[model samples]
Target: MKKQLLRRIGLLFFLFAFANAKGQSLYEIVFEASDITYKAFLVYFNEQDAYMRIGYTYKGKYNVVDVKYQSVTGQEDGYNYLVMVGSNPRFITNQEKGQSYNPDHFIWVWNDQNPNQLPYVTDDPNFDASHLIQCKSYIEIDPKTMTDSYLRQFFRTDEPEYQALRKMRDASAGAINYNTSDNNSNSGSSSNNNNNNTGSGKSKMHLLLVINTDIGDIGQSCAVDQKAMEVEFREIAKAVGMPFEKYIINGEKFTRDNVERTIKSMQVGNNDVVIFYYSGHGFRWSNQTDKYPQLDMRYSEYTPLTEKTSLPLSAAAKAITDKGGRLNIILSDCCNSDIGRNQMTSTTFMASRSFQGAEIQKLKKLFIDSRGSIMITGSSPGEYSWCNINGGFFTLSFIQALKEEIGYMRTGAPSWEHIAENAVRSTQYKAKNCNGCKPQNPVSAVRVSQR
Candidate 1:
């Protein structure tokens, strides 16, 4: 009887250990401006060690497994580097398993370079290959092991094009000096230029312009509310003490050539905050005809709209930054205007690269080195940007927030971060309530002052 009791106890202990080994907790770590801003509740035990998965939240919805990190590599410096394996596993069907099994979609060992420490490698490169199986986008890790004491790292294979793009972005961002003085003047008038001094060694102004192209037949197709946007822009400018201009593209009065010419002629210089606002029909097309998919920016146009006449984001950003300005803010409120567009066609070119007849090839690099500008957009690639008819949600919220900031409308003012936060929240709320309008995935690409 004693032997049988001991045997039973041992068997129970083994079962418990086995179950623990099979279950792991899921953790979500979000990084913004060098800090970990958000973390999700731990997801407990949904997969095995042989197979790994990662889950994250999108908007307010939980378990948005669209972008999965097959393996995670957590380093000492609070950077939760995500290793993108492929699209979410739930989207892959059994018949597609053969194609999914390709190593191109797998997460391998991370190649971290450390001058003072020894390099770390996985126990077996083939470990992932052996356990290759389809599972939902959830990673199973022991909760106890996830404590702050453990240092983890993840590896991801980077695509050539993606790597190149990231390199370009990083290079561009690195060119600017965020710590540079904002006291330099560009008004070209001695009295007004004297007024441009930054009292506390900080920027005299921070500008944000949100354009909603909802009016013109083409603009309506882009889903921008032009009138609402204009009202919001005018109000924000009035509050911020920045100059404002309107561009009517559909009418012959303001042709694309005229708009481009006006952009070229602007006299922007250091200490002057310049903002370019556009709300109109915009689309992306492939540089090569052979590409499998092509993205089109469709608007209800009485006249046919082509890519050649449209203003590209890259070009607009570069144009503002090139004029020696300490800071340039380009707020584009158009649908599908994010960075990942199909390659540009002959008629269409990247705004960032065009230089608009300027000789600068490395405009991003120049802006980054000089710390000249930042680009914020309404949505990411393949997403629709919306406008609220009642009142331009993004524009209205931005204006109201700025109005609260004292000294802004007046000659002397103190800037605050509340203005940015309020604008983001207002748009988020609007995106959530509007039908056919997904959450506005606003992306800020900048090399600005850390403060």
Candidate 2:
């Protein structure tokens, strides 16, 4: 089956290239609202190639010539004869002349006996002529007079007929006309130069995953965060249609310098969705500053109090702001040691840390003031972020939320706010079930003005 398909494809390409080289005038006979109701039938004719490609909307899917050398013979009586190319796999290995041939040397004979009967081809009772009975428009196209842009518009634009079919065709072919290479790069130079968005017209959303599993204080062999998070991260990214660059930092590798370098490597575009996710140990300084509250990066060369081991959370907001990203999100599945930041003044905060607290309010203020981004944390201040053999509870919950929230999206991708709501709910549920685990409620600082 594959061989036959490839052979037909090769023949089509050869025909197109050959006709173009010979300066042959290619004409397309288009019928609007013809046999295919509310759709268009485009038949291409090349005198040099003596072949035509029949493009049709069949069963709501656009299929253009799956077979080769289908004949369309027009007679002097203004009637046309068609012999559909047979779909057989053996034609690939066997190039016998009988596969396609002119019937009866283009002979035409009139038998007066068929005057009271329908055409022999339409004798099949299953054939439906209800749609074929109407003819809307019959137009001929000259490829020479039409610019490439005009030709594309003539076939694709002008109405709902061919517009949908053209889009379907482009999507089925992996959107080869669009450049998606920039999605892979982490460097600033790889930012998209093309002004156009993706084929779906949605802004390009990029993700940066930072997983730091091993805390040197906890034996390296015992740390299992990297493997656990990566599995779910990939699944979530695939479902959301977002491409990501991942960094797995373990043991002494999770240093402030390394984190800064990774953060600096990213370049977000103005019309892009940028997300940064970190899963590991985290802590706020005992003397936290409002301008730059630092989170301790677990397991590095520096001691606990040293600046080399601490990462400023503001850096993330700054990086995203520097690139003028439209939507920015930061997720930290880690713990903070400062209780001052996590003030439980409200009954809601005391009951469930996931509820709005001083910590969340401060973070919200920080982000809105800095870059108008959103922040989600796995646990409230002074609470430990729990993890089992599978992975961090918060990360797994976030992934689960993504699956559910993304499923609900009728069109395009889910908003970050929706995802955060689901994640917090799911995380609270997961934390409730774990025995001996403190009630860990994930919290978020969302800024609606950014949207």
Candidate 3:
């Protein structure tokens, strides 16, 4: 995605059962580039707290390396990548058991579903782009369910291997930086997260999940997004000490008519929060002057992109904002790319991670204290919003960023600006060298209200 390219992570090893811990998210990605191939396993906790086991064949036989790495999910370029960099790799080779430490400037920059992605690793921190290797056929597999005989050789999470990884994870647990997985589960306990909002009245939150679960292209991504948003907003509700009501607009009910009716007819109050989130296809028309993308609400694949079939994000935000809710959040996770071209969707790798416990005060500051409207689209105009088998990059980043902003371990004050900035970077990070699409930079417009 940039001048410093991937030399195939010098060839990376991975582990399979890095899958425990409800507070963590797990994955195994297999990709090939240049003369090297990688079957890498990741157990992600937060942005910085993650582990990797890389097995690769450099010149001859297969070699396995244990990487206790810190990762940054999004970068600044048009390319998006999960950048894992570490030092002092512990090797488990064919010639020996776990060997002595070898210091190397090891790095793996990859995005699933084939972007302009490559895994880089080298002893020289300033390695040139000439050595960079491009990866292809990137796929996420469940080792327990996979049938590949070759990958089975590298799938070891036995006692010794597990212990080594445990040491790696424990070493970084105290690091103050909060860069973890987007699939974080330890947000907070539901019981403790509930309390009085302002000691005046009970607040109600409306979570509108309008998705295109039936669309073939982005349906899977949307479905996964649907689930992730549900869990996240519920955490938000609990954080703000409010009761939330959920409304689903998907499948046959995903028509524009249905979506419009739902938003226009909702009963919202002054203390309420309306989160109108749409996940699926999005586009921009030729004459459209608005920077925000239009949501394609057609129910069938054969349906035409008409005025009746499309809805602008501004309209949705205005509609929800008109209801007099305390805070109105409009999130659109889809493409703002080529005219009428559907966003490229990849196959499923696994569901999407997070911090364990959430800080109630942080949550109150963002959700309860903040007022007015927040509009976030996954991409800016003329850019492609990226999604893989994992999930939509911007959506994942929003949740990841949100978790960090409110996590007890996070430093500094929590602000929506940080979340918006991170979401844009994260989306760009995942889109780097992506096969089908260009760089995606998320756009956010916030109007703070004094109530």
Candidate 4:
């Protein structure tokens, strides 16, 4: 059944790319309003730009290709939608051909109330002709959080997830032009001076994943968030063929002491790549000075919120930096608001994918090739970091941007600075576009160099 489904994924058809997900992301979505199950491939050029190859089947045999390749961030709700503004639905059967209109837009919604619910399109069916039958623009589609396994299923053959990553990059840069094998070979064969990495030289990198998923208020959401990070961080290592040592602190062992002990005692290669990711409640202390938020290390709702329960992001960065790893990255996806909102230092850091491929060269541009100390957060010091059941908006956006940097979304030198910029912009859009949500401008500090 899966292979048959894969066979039907005709080229040049529109796709959701699993909801502005990672670069070269592909997803098959079913809307509550239509019988047609849509397959989509979304590749982010940047947060403000994306290409969609919208496709659906006619009578379960023919593929409908309506490619509307444009940026579809939810202007109405930040990062919760893909507004394909057109009235034409392809009711035809053809092989790898163009449509009268681009039908590349697909809708995905986050089931905020029921976290376990698979994404069922929530767009109302009673809209005008301009909108697809039941496809509305408010459903949240988190393309950035998809696991590599589901991604692998999209190709009919047993293509490696990384290989698909390349095809998607190429398909994205050359929308409707998925057959760029010759060009890819040429590019792969060519020398790339920018990717001459100076890191620890293919040794085991280090990834530290810390999550407060068992904490009271947002525990459920945090669990999913933690899982996504695990998948993503591992995929990063796989994409670049980097051997890695992973350290995780969560559940009953989640405490400030554990994180501190782990970091202070952990041994990383002097030139290794180390990344620290944190997900949970975060805030600023009344007397704090840094722009990043502190980790809410408490593992249970009954735990007291005090100095013992928290770890500042800066301290973590400095600790990681002190280890002398060649390339270091720390990301905190909690709020930066004052501690308890009554200006207790207030509350919210408020905020907000993956792959492999020959575009593997592109991956080198950001991962294997760069050097520096980098840190980013989901929101500014005073705003609330927003999230639903899917994950933190900031984390999802970071994945999206990472995919963009490695995908064939652009040409020339791949850049860490560009990836950081896209992360901030994408998270900002998700916050700014929401109805009750306040605007969130993420904060990032980077001191990295790429040749």
Candidate 5:
């Protein structure tokens, strides 16, 4: 059945391709209602190449195509048949003698033969000739008149539908300001700061990874937000001087083998900061109950976990402290991420102190004596991390704050304190505006180097 369905779909595609090949001269007309400016363009396929002819529709005429070829231009005589009859029409005529022309052009066509067609063109059976309008235009080329090629529009009107369509097209053509930079410095600093910071090793290297384990068990809004956070963080890291080696794993391209490989390749030194972030489902071992209780770390209903999916936080902390690095910044976006209670119950004190279960400590740190470790988290124990699909509240504000407008508010380059403050502010704002979700709580802690 599946094979038959695939064959049918393939056949339909071939038929549609053939239909498009037959009617290749149809063009698109665009008009702006406000300015009363109009454009008409023909998109067609010849041989295997698709071409377009664009012109303006002025005073009920189109004057667009600029070139013309005589009959004796090519090797073929009248047999050439003027394959294309428009201004600036591109002609491609390479096909086998008996083969039909098939060019790559997308168009929609309707077949009136079958009334109960399962797949009909336009996807509407009620649409008929009355709903469609057709118009014709001419192309003129006169060398004596000094007009190379142009289209003569036959019909120019101010119909309601036409006007409405033109208005929509004009609105769509308008530019949107996706880059919300308040001043000129923000736009210029992205490149300029990168150049200045190229050789400056003043700040310690930090890799923060946040993973939300709540997704593995319960449905949480933070799962999707956590993914977006990782993407933004990676972009920020690239904008700064961090390599791909120093990244917090949050299922971006993470697998068991890749995770192990990343952990094994860690370098610990004075200037290196390694961060691990998790935001999904997390659980704490309950001694009295002798089972793990599902922590409400998400805005949705309470859901419990049977086993712990996240690495023990104590083990992770011990890994950075034992390596004697200048700084280690551990940032987690997960809720109820504390592993203190579970760590004390499950492992011996000596084993817990060592970086046995902790995977982030394997990096080779490369820093001097003047840096300290920083750990930032989305939420603390018994708190929920909120997320909305529209955007990551914490991350969006954090990035904006580091941007020129907010960063320039202070005297120097953005510090971790500034970024954290911005993230918290943004998260709170989003929580208040969001309908169903609770406020997101972000936490930060730093461990300085004694050396």
Candidate 6:
């Protein structure tokens, strides 16, 4: 009976020892960044001579990492490093010598929330990737109740894992430095870019002018002042450093194919800006559930409108966006009423005044660096974009806003948002209050997709 009792006790002890040695949790480590949290497990296995393994789940797959030490140095042996394998190996650090291992000193890869933001990198040696994180993003370790002392006790300061971790950290830092340099070259400095031809620290601006002076019918006709509006647009483009090309479609030349060709030929890049100007008639086609805007390119005689005779505004916008223009401005000075006919009216108003030489100089001095598309319409849907002997109210206000200095010139060029707001307000005030003028309302829309 005594021998049997002793045998039972020995069996229990052996089973417990084996289970503990097979898979022991040494530490559950947490690394935090601004937008992501990486949870790593420091696991000890007796089968491999008590070697430590890092286990983590990435993209929903379990990754078991075998890291070799790269370095561990400090008066109190504070630094500990271990690295996985790859050309751009991910990093895991316990602490750095003579420095507190705070969450703030974390390497930020990229913003997970922002789909457009790419990783920022640099090539500067001694450059730390930790500073890449913005204040809003952060990482946190799990098992919050775990003691810090218990975690620190598992550190092997003299092991190969320490040195390997250091190597991983350096590699990540270099990648960050490289990314930073690349973004700066493309976005912040014109001299570093080959696409910015003039080295004026400004991206090239291209303008395509489309004017329709002869819509044929008297009611659907723009005043003779349409020519004056075109000239004003040319001057505004010159003042704003745009090399513009104008195309007038009055009779048979006005067609969807021609307009599509013009848009396709723009070939805008990340360092290029495009302005599409259309002055004529805007048509709205309705089929119960939908109402779409189209630019009418009517011939001299009254004829039924066909697909070849007009271009859909949506189609034009899609072409511009698809062409990858960094900044796209669409200015349409036309009637947007859905009545299937253009408003015919002659105004005594002449072309509105243009900006002064000094104002133009101020615009030339300003540098705008932004990406996205903004559309400024002459009038809202169901309203007539009034054109007088002076000019179209919408175009006039747009030009005036470009000329006026909202802030200091050196701070940077006026944002599309600022310009659009100013133009919309100015046009509304002038159109509603002007004598013998029909009520007109300007409409503006913006899409900042890839700034």
Pick by lDDT: 3 or 5, better one:
3
**lDDT tens readout by residue for model 6, 337-376:** 7644444333222121221122233334332445578887
Which runs of model 6 end up more than 4 angstroms from their true locations? 1-202, 217-251, 288-292, 340-354, 358-367, 405-413, 434-438, 448-451
lDDT of 2 by residue, 1-451 (tens): 3224323333443343345332011233333332552222232211111223334454465433322222222112322222122221221122335443111111111224422212111111122222122133334443223443543433444534244334323433442221111222232212222232343244444555555544544222124444434444433333234444455444556666776776676665555556676665566666765432355665543455566666666676566557676667777666655521111110110011010001112222222222356777777656666655445666656654543332211123345566677677656645553444567777687774522
lDDT (C-alpha) at residue 201 in model 1 = 32
Question: For model 2, what is the C-alpha lDDT against the true structure?
Answer: 0.42
Estimate, for each residue in 1-451, the C-alpha lDDT of model 1 and write its tens digit.
Answer: 3224323323432343345332112343322212212221222111111122222333343331223222222212321121222223341112233332222123212224421221111112232333322222223232224332221121122323223223333433444211111223121111111122242232233232222233343333223333434443333333333444444333332345554666676655465556655554334454433111112223234445565445566666776677666667676655553323211111110011111011122221222223445566555555555643323334444433333332111122223343455456555644543334456655555556522
Write candidate 5's Cα lDDT for 230-254 as tens digits.
5443334333434433344433332
C-alpha RMSD values across all candidates: 20.6, 23.3, 12.3, 12.5, 22.1, 25.7
- The TM-score of predicted model 5 comes to 0.38
TM-score, model 6 to reference = 0.47
Question: What lDDT tens digits, residue by residue, belong to model 3 across residues 219-262?
Answer: 87788788788777875675556776778888878988887787
User: TM-scores for all candidates?
Assistant: 0.38, 0.44, 0.63, 0.63, 0.38, 0.47
User: lDDT scores for all predictions?
Assistant: 0.35, 0.42, 0.63, 0.58, 0.34, 0.45
TM-score, cand. 2: 0.44
Candidate 2 — which residues are off by over 4 angstroms?
Answer: 1-205, 216-244, 247-251, 289-294, 300-302, 338-372, 408-414, 448-451
Q: Model 4 lDDT vs. the true structure?
A: 0.58
Could you tell me how far off, in angstroms, the CA of residue 165 lies in candidate 2 after the best superposition?
Answer: 26
Please report the TM-score between candidate 1 and the true structure. 0.38
The number of the candidate with the highest lDDT is 3
The Cα error of candidate 1 at residue 431, in Å, is: 1.8
